[model samples]
Every structure is written in structure tokens, then in C-alpha cells.
Target: MSPTRHGWITTPLTAGLIRGALDLERTERGLLPHRLPARARAQCADPQLHMAESQPSGVRLVFRSRATAVELDTLATKRVYVGAPPRPDGVYDLLVDGRPAGRACVTGGATLTIDMATGTVEHRPGPVATVRFTGLPAEAKDVEIWLPHNETTELVALRTDAPVEPVPDQGRTVWLHHGSSISHGSDAASPTTTWPALAASLGGVELINLGLGGSALLDPFTARALRDTPADLISVKLGINLVNTDLMRLRAFGPAVHGFLDTVREGHPGTPLLVVSPILCPIHEDTPGPSAPDLGALSAGRLRFRAAGDPAERAYGKLTLGVIREELARIVRERAAEDPHLYHLDGRDLYGEADFAELPLPDDLHPDAAAHRRIGERFAALAFAPGGPFANGSG
Candidate 1:
């Protein structure tokens, strides 16, 4: 039962309604969403992973309520790179019974400024803000408040004119997907619109997104997390992060892929697991990277990225998208012989030259909102359509 105070009922925020997060941390402020479990987080001190896990990319509060008024309090921590353009306010998408209802944004959140060139950081404190929606229908119905995909948010409180409760499970297939920033909804309009979220909606499945911005570097802990998570379908989009971060060489990439899959198969031996190569990233397609910001664009008040590594380095075994794709395809083919449930999807097939000519990645990296929709629709048709690997009962 919800606690009532002066006609208003307060609901405790818990995992019941929160989607897309693997785990939640209770804090003095309220709850902090984490894509990785506590054990996984404790094993890695990488700042990229820390920031990515806390951003609440596909996390949302979903429930059924008859409340005419609802209010949520959040303490958000937003990022600011010294030379880049100011990011727009984070958006919260509200949906009623699977349809759009309203949208809101929290202001006055703390800011974390980074000097990318110097690797320095500064913190500016702000205050918690409230987002309220009034005039909701007084009839009990399903409601979802999707948190911002780009900002790290801490839920503080939830109050409503009528009590709210978790919506009972509807027996949807659960899809657990992991990838890089693009999959994390980097430039997607909102949480529900992220590619994985979009695909899940189109495929009629529950989503547990593990798309950790710049941290999808085949970490053992992440594989362990995937190993233990419950899911009816699984996918891992690899390559770009590994190349852009220049984290490993061609020699180590193959083994890492094998090890990651081996770990996941330990828990999900016959689960339909899809291995996706990197999408079309022209700059890093042939050239190796440790991608750097496009200072030219930055100077003109825009932010863009450019591959900074020499193309010649490929001869030395430095990884590139081209090489990664070839290797991933080979790896999948060899393993699929023994693991019939395993499958491979060329990322280029989802977004290749033809699509790039039409949609063009604005930042030379992440796709914009429109492209995300396109990819999501394509993925659903390819992966969930009849006879597809992820089709109902395929496993």
C-alpha cells in the first residue's frame, strides 16, 4: 500500500517499474540507475564505464495509476566538455498506455565540466528539481516516465494524487542488448526512442539495454553481467569503441570476442545470441583511430569527431572497422557450427553506404534521431521477422 499524506500518496521508487537498468542503487537522495551490477562496477575504475552506467539511457519509471497529478523530484548531474557547445536540457518522455502523453525537463542540476585536452575536471554544484504533470486522466491506466538518456539522474521522490503500482508483466520476450554509445542512445531524441528501445517496441519485447556509451570494450565484467542477466534474446554490437579508444590490437581482438561469448554461453547456452559488427563510421572504416574531436567544427560552435590514428598503422595490426568486421564474421561462422543458436548480422547491412549517403552521421560518429528510427525498424524486420534468428520460438 502506498503511504497517504493529506490526500496525496507517495510511492517508493524501486526496480519494479524501472526498465532497462540491470541494477539500482539506493542513495540518500533516492535511487541511482546502473547498467552494470554492483559487483561489475566494483571491478572496474574506468571513468568512461562509471559515467556511462549512471546516465540512465533507457531507464524509466513505469506503473499504472489513476492520478490526476504526478510529480517527480530528481538530482541530475550533467556533463560539459570545455570547448563543446552546451548540451540541451535533458528530456523526460511521458507515455500513457503505450502512447505519447507529455514531456518535461529538469533544470538546475549539478554540472561536471571536463577539460578534454588536459584530462582535468571541475564540479559545479546545483540543486534538485521537480518535474510535474497535471491534468492526467483520472482513470487507472499504464504510465511511463522515461528518464533522460544523456544525464546521470538520481531519483529523489515520487508523489501523486492517486496511488500508483507496478504494471503486471504481460509475458513479453525480454531482449538484453549491449553495444557502444550509439546503442546507448547518444544523440537519440529520448530514452524510449533509443535504437534498442525502438527495436524492443517494434519487436514487442522487454528491453534491458546495456549500451554503455564509450565503455563497451568487451570487458570481462560486462560479459559476466550479461551471463547472469535473464533474457530471451541477446546481441552485442562490437568494434567502434575498441577502435576509437585504440584499446587493443588485431591479435587480441579475436580472443576477446571468443572469451566474451564463452562467458555469456556459460549461463545462456542455447539463447539466441547475435553478434553485430560496427555500423558505418566512415572516418574509422579504413583508418585506425583514437578518434579526436574536430577542432575546426568545435571552433565554429559545433562538435564533431575525426579519426586521429594513421591509416598506415593498420599494417602494424592496429584495429579498424574493416578488420573488425572480417574477424567478427569469421568468429561467428566458426562458432555457429557448434552453437546453432548463434547468429551474425553485418552492422553495415543495418546502416551502410546507401543509408549514409541519405542520412549522413552528423558527428561522423553517432547517428541522429531519425537514423536511430531507421536502424530500429530495419533491425526489427531482420531480427524479429518470421524465420529471423530472434523470431518468436527460434531458440
Candidate 2:
């Protein structure tokens, strides 16, 4: 039964073969990965968070094998807007012994279409598809298949020409990161190219990305999850999602930030923790958000975003990017005296005005693919370089 099809050996998907997900779900079709555990998921029934947490931003399948070919069967759920252009197919990247080896995209899967204006959704089911990678060296090697960061996927099946085994621990430093859609690889080309993934590669560390799209709103459970997860280094990128969602005012945000950090500290008080502020977002910098899709652009078959909140709302303590950054810096500064390991990194250093001019965010919010690469490289240089906050053994 194991070698039923040709000489391909079908290996059952298991937790040890995967990385970067907190939970594995036994779905009707296959194994679905969830960033948040079921306990945390039950606390909030928000559909957006449900979708984001299942997108597998930093999730990958890692194993040791001597196979020359591998094939994976997956069932993916892709999102579509009623009026906008069709989203590109999600990319699956193959890495052989820690290097880019091959890439392919799944063809058929379910589609969920949403009408932004009407708040309507239509679900159209599709078929399961296989993503195959061949032409590998016929020698023992570590194999990794990075899943798509922008689509929901279920691991249906795994097959290889040779038997596979769990990869031995490499003793690499573990780096955990949290943020909004940008960190979730919203506009990134592939999984490994996501800024956090790229940064992890450059820093030579293992990555645990908790970058939930539009859902990084300083949830207590998320922080608790971060608190409990094991890692040698940790960084939480805050501000973008909060501003865009208009989740709270300054009065509440300050306490929420503190509470989030407090929960994480409860678990790893000595871990080299980094608190990063919002990056340069022009629309939300001086103005408050509730960002909304640009209806005019939508009519023209383009997807764009615009700030919906009034700038004058700042008088009411409504949070803006500029306000949040200042507050984050001050909070870190005040807390650092008592907690020596706490640190803050201005998000602007990752993407500033000059970088914006050169590579503007295509949707007036999320960075484009090129910007993702630039941000990733810059983060690696600043955070992992000598004398940096995440520099060698700072933890």
C-alpha cells in the first residue's frame, strides 16, 4: 500500500516534517496548518483572522531524503475579489540542501470570491492538484518545500522516489517574528522571498513567523502564544494593522502594547526581544485610518487603498502611524531602564521616503515584491549585522 503508485512512496504528513505552524488540522481532504491554536481560535470568530492564520506565511515541509523527484498533492483555497483582476496562482518553492532548486504552482483548487462593497462571498469548489519537483541530485540531502504565503492550503499527500526521514536539528538560532500583512508576504513573489524568511536565511536562523494578515491587532492570545513558543530570538513588528483597522485609541493602545509585551516577558523575560514600530506608510503617517479600498480605482479594474478616517480625529487620541511610532519608541525607552534587554527599531529604517519613491507600494499600502526584497535585505543588515540588536548571542 505504501508503494502503490509506481515506485513513489507515499509518506503520511506529520508534525515533525513541518515547521512554523502551531497546529495541524485533520481536514476532510488532508492536513491543514494553523498559525494559532484551536483555543486561541475559539476566542474570536472573526473570519478575517481565520483566513489569515491559515495562510501558512512561514510554513514549510522539511525532511531528509535521497530521492531524485518529489511530488506533493495539495488542496488550496485562493481568494478572489468580485470585480478585480484574478489573483496569481500561489507559488510552491523547493529547496534542496538549503538552496533554491525548483519552483512550481498549483493549478486547480477552490476559490472564494468576495464583493468588498456588498460584503458578499461566493465559494466555488475546485479539484486537488499536485506540485511536483524533479531533477534533484541522486544523493542524500535535506529537502524543504515552502508553502504559499498568500493562500490557504491543505497538505493532501507526500510522495518521493525514496524513503524520507525527519531532518536532524541543525542547532540554528530560532528567530520568531510577528506583524501584519506585509510580514505575511501579501505582495511577495514566493514563500522564501518573504522579508522575514529572507532575513532568517541571511541571519542563519530558524524562523517562526506569526505574521497574520490584517489580524496583528495585539491580541492577548497571540502574545500568549508567542510567550509560550520556544525561540532564541523574537521580534514583534507593530502598528500597521492597528492603524488600518482603527482598532483602538491611544488610551487603549498603550496598555495593549504593554500587556502584549508583558505576556511575552512572562515566558521569556531574558530573550532578546525587539519591538519594531510602523514602517513609512504615507497615507497613514499623518492621517488616521480605517483604510478602505479606493472605489474609483476599483471601478477602473485596479486595486488600491485610501485612508477613510479623518486626520482631525487625532485630537480625539485616534492613533496614526506617526503617533504610534513616537509612542512605541517612548514605551521602549521607558521600559528599557527596568528591562535591559528590551529594544525598539523604527520601521522607517526598513522602508523610508526615499525607498518609497523608488519602489512605491503598489496598492498605496502593502509593499510590492521588490520592496519586500529591499526591506528583507535592509532588515538583515541592520538587525543581524555586527553590533545590531539581534547580533550574535545577544539573547
Candidate 3:
């Protein structure tokens, strides 16, 4: 929990607070800045690269793309490390669609801390603060989040959102989405252009994206996280991550899903929850799926392989979306008798034959920007529009 300007103790941050702070400071009135090279001073030529508040409460800067891209979502276990420190008295602003979404403040101030030798700016009296922007435009496409004070303050560690984004208003709805790398927006053009973002735009609902890149294995923590977060509409896109990770066998898969949903039900109770299985992938379609990697690609420093060994050496390794869908549908139907809101939607509904042919994924793993829009548009039409196909049945 970052400190408030008024010295109030808020557990988590509200978006409104974030906006107010950036505006108070009038940080975003100028052009974007660029980040300098590792050998040069922290300040650079590009507008986005320089530290500036896009809004009074939100700050942003173009991070040194050449250095390292910061990881956004992660479990509580890992620690974040920054190459250089931020300038003293600097404030970081978060921007949504080139506007403010949030900001971070450097505290325990110590200036003149640039490391000429290592090109790392280490500030004294650590503990930087963050404030997030709320009442955001539902149509927001991308979020421009910046860490201010690059010359003196280094963001070495971070904590996850404590309580998570809140539930929608009394009359409004919440959208909960889960998926793998595509859902996590790996190769997507920009943050706002993700399919989930597009869908949220069309649906006019709050979003909680639980899409982890290579980590969605029906883990118990993820289930608990979903179960605990508040929501009005929920959807989980399963299968691909499971297939790619090769985490469990068919025998264990069914029980794991049932248990995961059971956890979600604890908090949502009767809220609508949709389970979406994988979309079509030719590599794993007809043949037995590979739990291990194609080592030929890995040795080149390109593709990553999680599991070990070649296909011939493995005895138990196939887990298909077709298999999971059947099992998941059964679970939903079984539970629907007791919980009417339980539902299942096949992933093909988002991207089937026609759409796939029109906007094919680049690497055959994730969808492109055009596909993202298509998926989001299709999702909105099918799931959110009143009396649509996947809506609450009037019958």
C-alpha cells in the first residue's frame, strides 16, 4: 500500500487517487521523453523515455526498451530488480491510452546518487510510494505506467494488488477472464490492444485479467485468487497452457478443474462463471500432444521448452483441449443443478474456421492485433449483449 498525499492509510489504491496526484503536480503537460543508453546519463532524447507525469496523479516514461522490459504480473514469490535508480523527488505516472492511470513517488530522499561506474542510480532512504488512477475511461486501449526518478530511485521490489480490483457498482457488472500467453498479451501489439481489453471496452465492464503466460496450470493459488476476487461475470479459457506445460495427466485433469471451480464458487456463490476450453492448434490437434519441448528449436535460443525429453521416450504425456472440454462440460452440468449460473463455452466460439483463416496467429501460439479485435468483438456480441447467445437465458 503506497502512502497518500494527505497521509491517510489506505490499504490498496484507488484509481481516482492516482489521477488526483498526477494532476496536482501537473506532470503530463509536456512532450514524452526518451531513456538514455546504459553508458549515458539517465535522461534521454525520446519523450516517452524521459520521466514525466502524463496526468497530475499518474506518471509515465518510456522505459529503456534496450535494457529490459519489466515483468507486470507475477505471484508474490519473485522479487523485481531494476538496473538503475530514479531521480530524486521524481514521481512515476501511470497512463491509460496516453492518459494517467497511476503514479509512484520516491521517498526517503537522497539526491546526487548516479553511479558513474555502473550507470546505476541508487537512492537513499528507500520505500517509494504508488497511487493508482480510477474512474478511468472504459474504452482505454493501453496503460502507460511509469516509474519516476530514474536517476536516484530504483524500483527493486514490488507487491501484488492486495485485495485486487473491486467489484462493479450496484447496477454494473464485472468481467473476470483467465487464459494463457495470448490472454496475458505476450506478443500483442500493445497493452490496451489485448483481446481482453477490447472485450472489456465493448462490454463496458470492469476487468480482472488472470492470464498468466506459462503459469496457468489450474494451480490452487489461482483458484483461490479467483474465488476470493469479487465479480459479476466470469470466464476461464483453459487447455492450451495445460497442454504446453504438460502439468497433469487426463486422470488428474478432471479432478483439478472440479476443485478449481469449487474454489471459485466459494466466493462467487451464484454469479455467472463461464469455462472456455482451448481453441484450434494444428500442432497438437490430431496427434498425441507433446508434454516435452522440441529441443531442435530450444538449442537455437528461441523457443522455450518446459518439460524434458523427446516424444518417443515418453509414456504418459498427452492432454488435449478436446479431452478437457468434455470433462469441463460434464462438471458444469453436474454443478449447474445446484448452481444455476455455471456455464461452459467452447473456445472455438471466439476463433473458429472463418476467423482463423482471416487473421491467423503469427507463431501459431498467440493471436495478432486484428484477431484480438475480432475475438473481443465476438465475445461482446455473444456474451454481453442482452438476449445474446451466451447471456443469462430468458427461458
Candidate 4:
């Protein structure tokens, strides 16, 4: 254990768990130890041994799925168990030392129960069903879980085997982020594969992912979510969704962003907030509100296609990434004078020019998994580092 972080601590309080929701199985090793429980000494060798030290502020896993499976392989030294009633719709990943030890599987339509009192997984498979694992290692690391498709799941709680006390954070730093589906992580491999999650991993900071899928309309609710959440660092990726959805008029777009940011400022005051405009999207490059859609393809199956906007629409009520980018730059510049902590990151900095040269979006809307990795790396380089580039003020 590094002195830089505290020993594993268990909480009398068990944060509620999320069940049956679609979640992907993946391993994330870079979580800050603040709220995580320290790995147990007894069960350190099991590859399936996974633990979440900090109980209250546990990790959240979001994924798309229909039926899910999670597995944790345990060693002889430790036993994983259930702490609370399993979410009726979902199953608990066998947990050791407050972390994911193994996987659980559940189907829709029936209730799955974990008898916390008896330490067992019980199920009545019906229109739906669930499976759970128990008796796992306390110091486990590797974990595998299955989740349903096309839905989101946030893992809010876990229990651990090691015993310790909570430690208050001594540093004054915050992290904030914003984005579209890619940032929201649409169809990118797994829950951990989301760019925001990846960036949060490398940066080592609290992540408030405001990456809404097809919903980053600079909406007040979106901004309010950011404003209401505590943050030391902030970033916003705007535009593509706006173009894709044709949600607002150009006249209303710029000021709405300004207003959304203004509201966030009211809550954060001194926090550093970065506003990111869209990366290039050839489909919406010159396009306007009426983005071309393939209704015929839609009628045929799940296949859909799009084309660029009319130049005339760009002249009128159209929304283009280029146009929005120009406005966002101007807004940030004007606001920076009033707020010294404010920063502006060209979305292209995360993925522009050469990036587009290598990985063009297949549908001309969303980036592929490889692109998500590239963007995550670029973001880590430009925004997050040891000295705390994204750490608000003084590192």
C-alpha cells in the first residue's frame, strides 16, 4: 500500500446496489483509492478476486444489454458473500472485500434474491431469471460480468472483507466533463470503454460524466446536472447532437450555451470549466437542421444512412459543427475574462485533423471503439497529468 493513499476502510452503511440493468464486464485498475476499500491481504492471489474499498462512493458501470452474466473465481483463502437483497431484476456479482469478485447472471421478468441473512443466491427462473456466486477471495482483482444490451447501468454499491476506517480527503481538487454519445459511450465495446471513463481513469479524478446520448442539446437540465454536481474540473463537448437532432435554431443555440454555462458558474464559482465544441463530422459538416435520413433503410431493417446538410440551410437556421465551434470559442473567450479558472479546449484537440484522417465515423456520427481509445489518450495528454492540468487550480 502506498502512503499516498489510505488503508482499506469498510463502512457500516452499504450503498444500494443496481440490479438487472444492462452493464458490461470489464476491468478498471486506475480508480483513486479515496472511497475504495483496501485489498484484503488474505485473498490476494485470485485473478477473479475483486474488491471495492470505499463503500459509499463506489464505482458505476454503464452498459447496454438484455441478459447479463458476471463471474468471479475465488481461491481457498477467502469467501465472497452478498450484503443486501439482490436487486429483484439483477444479480450481485459475487463480492469479496467490497469489490466485484465474480459475475452474476439475470434475465428480465422474474425476481432474483440474495438471502443476506443466509449468504446464498436464490432464483425462480420464469419469464426472467438470475444467478449469483458466493464464497470469494477478499483481495481479488480480476472480474467478469455480463449485462444486457442497449441500456445503461450504474454500479452504486459493493461490500468488502477488509476492515478499516474512512479517511477524509486532504486535497482541494475537482474534475468535470461533458460530451455526446461517444463521451456518453454509445456502442463502444463495454461500459469501461467509454471515453469519459477512460479519461477519468488516466486523470485520477472524480468524474461527473454528462455525456448524454443524442441529448447534449445544451439543454438546461444537462447544464443543471453539471451545476448541481460538485466538480473541481469541467469540460463540455457540444454540437453534433444538436445537428443530428435538429433541436434548436442557430439564433437560440449560442446564448443557450452561454446561459447553461452561466448557471453552472453560479454553482461552481471558482471551478475550472472547459467547453468543447464538436470534432469534425462530414455528414453534418455542411449540413443544417434537416439532416438526410434513410427512412427506406430504416423500413428495411436496422440499417440507416445520412448525408451532409444543404449549404443554404447553413445560411439560414442550420446547425453545423463548424458554426457551433465558432460560437463556442467566442463564448469561452468572452467568459474567460470574467473567470480566470476558465479554459477552452478545441474538441479537435481530443480528435481532429490527423485523427479524422485515420478514423472516420462509420455512420458519420459516432466514433468506433478504436476512436474512443484515441480520444481518451489525447484527452489524457492535453487535460490530465501528474501536475494536475485538469485539477482546477494549484496541483
Q: Estimated TM-score per prediction?
A: 0.97, 0.98, 0.57, 0.64
Native-to-model Cα distance after best TM-score fit, residue 233 in candidate 1, in Å = 0.4
Residues 258-366, model 2: lDDT tens digits:
9999999999989889999988999999899999999889999999999999999999999999999999999999999999888899999999999999999999999
What is candidate 4's lDDT per residue for 1-395, written digit by digit as tens? 11211332222211112211112233231111111112221323322112211111113432221112222221111112244212222233333322344544344432334332343555443331324444544332333232321132223222233332332344634565666666766546544456765676567654545455555667565566567666677788888878877778789997898898998898898776777778767667676644444555444433334854576877777787788888888988998888887777778877776888898775557787799888887787777764434743424
Instruction: Please rank every candidate by TM-score, starting with the best.
Output: 2, 1, 4, 3
Which candidate achieves the best lDDT against the true structure? 2
Better candidate by TM-score, 2 or 3: 2
- Cα error, residue 53 of model 1, in Å, equals 0.6
Query: What is the overall TM-score of model 3 with all chains considered together?
Result: 0.57
lDDT score of model 3?
Answer: 0.51
Per-model C-alpha lDDT, please? Answer: 0.91, 0.92, 0.51, 0.52
Off by more than 4 A, model 3: 1-171, 291-317, 388-395
By lDDT, is 1 or 4 better?
1
Give the TM-score (vs. native) of candidate 2. Answer: 0.98
Distance (Å) between predicted and true CA of 54, model 4? 24
Stretches of candidate 4 off by over 4 Å are 1-136, 140-150, 153-174, 296-302, 386-395
**What does candidate 1's lDDT look like per residue over 1-395, in tens digits?**
46666788888888897887888899988999888999999999988789889999878899999998888999999889888888888999998988888988988989999877677888898899999988899999999998998899999889999888999987778899999999999888888888888988888888888999999999999999999998889999999999889999999999999999999999999999999999899999999989988888877778899999998999999999999999999999999999999999999989999999999999899999999999999999899999888996422
- Sort by lDDT, top down from the best: 2, 1, 4, 3
